[model samples]
Target: MLHAYVLYGVAGLMLVVRGIETEQRDSRGGASWNEVITDIGNERWTDYYIRCLHPDVIRPLIRGDLPKRLQDPEFRQRVSASLNLHATPGVYLCQFHQTGHLQPGDSQETADTLEQRRGAGLTLRQWLMVVDDCRLYSDVNNPASRNLAEQIDSAYRTTRATNYASNQRRWQSGTRQQNFAGLEEFLNMMDRRWLNWARAQLGTPNEWILDVPMVRAPAVVGQSKNVTERASHHLALSGSSYVHSLISCIVKFRFAYRFDRSVWQLARVERPDHMNLCEAIFSILASAYTWELGLNQTVSGASHQAGSHALTASALNQIYQQNRDENLRLGNVDKSLMLDEQLVQRIKEIKAFDKIKDQKFAELDEREKRVVEKGRKMDTAFEALMAREMSGLIRLQHRQALEASRAAPA
Candidate 1:
């Protein structure tokens, strides 16, 4: 009797394993294993958005064709109001049509206009914050529009005052003569570093061409020996300012481009190359902004330098953290685990068992949460490893420089 009981126990264990395998196989029926594998390997929210906006295999769904459930009337109203779409419907429509996205048009011209507007807005907001962070625009007697207009006026005055001072210093020194050279230097540095960093992050060298030229003031008035010198100066200053403004706008445009590219890459279920590119660009921008704020402090001779510095630092830190979180959320591991017949069979079996039992035991929510957490941890670890690698490279470069210096008998 004891021998018979042992044989029955072994048989029961074998049956249980077989049943589980059978259940898995049933659940995965009718599903494309290749697609499942791709989804698992390329986990990214941007990928969904990219496909929705610019699909390849299936022509992109038109905006009008989007499901009603996805279109929130209230959100659309808010966006319309904030963007002043009512006043510029045609312009916005043309922009959207050209860019192939529903988002506000970010064409080169539009970007310049937006930057000018943004600068105006930022100046007004900063002034209001100084007056009263909470109730700066709460006066019933003063129209909000009028208040904003006044703030912008004050800000421009302040900017002009600072610019005039700088111009005076340039005139006093021989530096004014070299303004064109300085502009060239600035443009060269921006172009070289921006392209290099962009290429590194994209992992596709030579994909883009940096064709924008260094801006310079127009030749002196009547230096042409034909026109009035005063008029020429006016034209030169205006032209130079326009060029500077456009370049600044391009910087913002590049930010938006990378954002869109990241989404596209995700949609195509490509590698994490774009994420790396986004991170690198964000880092460079943060570093540049920090340096600019420091220079602002030295030039302004202001007591609130520390506070401004902290604000700028916080903004950069926030951007970096946000990018890191996004990268973590989008990254996928176990990509090597392809969607083969075995995996498909296993999934099918699980689904069939759940259906037969009339009670879900797969615990999909729990499983998904565990997977996401694992991916986040893996991303963080990878970032840390890269940071260490960069540090090592820097040290090696420093050592090489030191050896060269010693050998040169400085």
Candidate 2:
């Protein structure tokens, strides 16, 4: 599982780097794209965003025996303290279609946006407490959660403010971010004698690996291998995979929010930011709950655009070229027909062949036209869908802001 996770991260990092390189080559100011491309290539900042957005590793952390273990008060307190200590400072809400603000420019929309922005951002500790402890989406009229929300909010504001200032000073003093080669670094550290001794003192992995089958594949005789091979081949398609990986990172992390770098820098604490590695992972994973809800349409639209631009979907251009080659091959076959016939019969046969070929060519042309038209219609529908989803997200944000206000202490 660790191996698969690292491989996926590496593959994603490669795509991100390649995509930036591609963008630079094609665009006018490609040369100007430097540090960000390099950082992403090296698995630095981009890894943080990618992990936060997808949280694929969260599956094991939540479902494993850990949650049951967390039910113990002492264990929960330790976990909570670790989370607060290492938690990345600041609230990272979805930007929602890169608008930063909603349409119609209404006063209500403005107020909702301001309300969300004005709060002292939640640290991971505060975020989890508010999200899990208060059960923000549920607990309608529940006084316990409401009171906890107020208490957590008060505590979080104070905690985040103090940390943010310290982080800002650290950033100003040119403190370098620790080179985190993701989870694999821990294994490397463990190999050293002193680190091995430290680990023996620290203890070993405790989380239970459940044997439950998440995806079941019933035994199939002959066809299974062939199908699996075909699927692997499709996954190997370079242009499509790179385009997909890049677009996913962009739409999920990049387009969802546009952070002011200066403001965001203040939120950075020295590494190791959170206490328990697994808990920190889970927190980042769970952080995407709201963003995923709102950005569904935007994701679809971006995927469609990648498919169209990269020729990743149907390879429509390749199909067109293939059709042209087929036409040429047919024409060549027709010329061979003339050699096999007598003079008078050959003339008649050539005319007959010409009519048949023209009919076949006409049919092929019609099919290509239909395919192109279908793609166009799909693109149009995708745009409309995105617009509707964005509007809905705006309303949802407004409603959430209102609900939060009502729940706040008077």
Candidate 3:
């Protein structure tokens, strides 16, 4: 006899975990072990890892650095489907639909049901899930919200539909206010005929409110010869449909510099690679990521082993201090490096991203390096200890990933 417990099912508006029920079975069988560890089980770092690793690991993986085995078409699809569920469970059911867990026409119904949940004041992300998972518009779902999600979705569709989507796409994330340009320059480049028409209707563009997002729908009192085109022109001029082009000034100019394996944490949003940006990420991993070990700080580098040497924080600190130099401090580094010189270069290059259109990524790939590597010389012993501990963490929990993956719902 085996048991099958329904955690959530399509019995009502929102599926709540149902009670367990047992049934007889000749052999015990269920989801694979990998599914359980990665999706179903409460394995260590399995939950928080995705959130923390988004900018660090997931970004790289998304940019085509996934493990070779996971690169297969079928495996990639599985990973993508798994990502859909894990990114926003219950709210996002793309994987369910793909796996025959959801009926063909259930997406709209789910959206309607989820729309009410959004009306009660869910987060922006939650509202976005409805937009992505359900066909319902935010305005249609709840007019009170000013249809922010719906409007954004519509803008995205328009942009993506236009040739501009590929033309104006950002190469990567973590680009925070590096450029310096005048708003007048942007206005000067606009189509003169269109701008003249817009000026006649809306008057002079207020420099201050130029970047402010227009919340309400565009108004066209009476039809003109080119009314539909004029409406688009008006919306583009006054609304936030293309605000990115207007906002060229720097918003935040915080410093972010990286070495061979260290990142100076100047801004919180600037996530650094855990392995390379050693200090910024190590503290979090050491404190939060190692909770499952039960050996918190006890055996940081296998000191508990019968014949191995014990590692100490003081020793690691000495190594870190030795490698880091005067440039480690913000006031001591170059202005260019501080501004993330590589990122600035990438943005400039990507602006003319069409220059090398024949090339894969259009020469944008070479410019994505945001960090300046000075190759700080940390003590070999310290490096060995860090590597050993991190490897141990992964190796120790490797089986859990397999188990959790298998345990995940089909």
Model 3 TM-score on a 0 to 1 scale: 0.14
Kindly list the per-residue Cα lDDT of model 3 for residues 74-146, writing each as its tens digit: 7445334222211211110000000112335567766554432221212222222322322222112344333
The clash count for each model shown is 12, 2, 22
Over 1-410, each residue of candidate 2 has an lDDT whose tens digit, in order, gives: 33444544423333543574556545634322443244334332223334334333343342344445456677555444323323343221121111234445468866565444321122222222222331221232455534543443333232222222232211123221221121122223213312233234333331111111101101000111111212112211121121222212222232233211111101222233222332333243223321321211112223312211111112322332443343354353242211122222323443565576699899999999999999999999999999999999999999999999999999
TM per prediction: 0.17, 0.17, 0.14
lDDT for every model? 0.29, 0.32, 0.26
lDDT comparing candidate 1 with the true structure: 0.29
lDDT of 2: 0.32
Candidate 3 segments exceeding 4 Å error: 1-140, 158-332, 335-410
lDDT of 3: 0.26
Model 3, residue 205: C-alpha shift (Å): 35
TM-score-based ranking, best first?
2, 1, 3
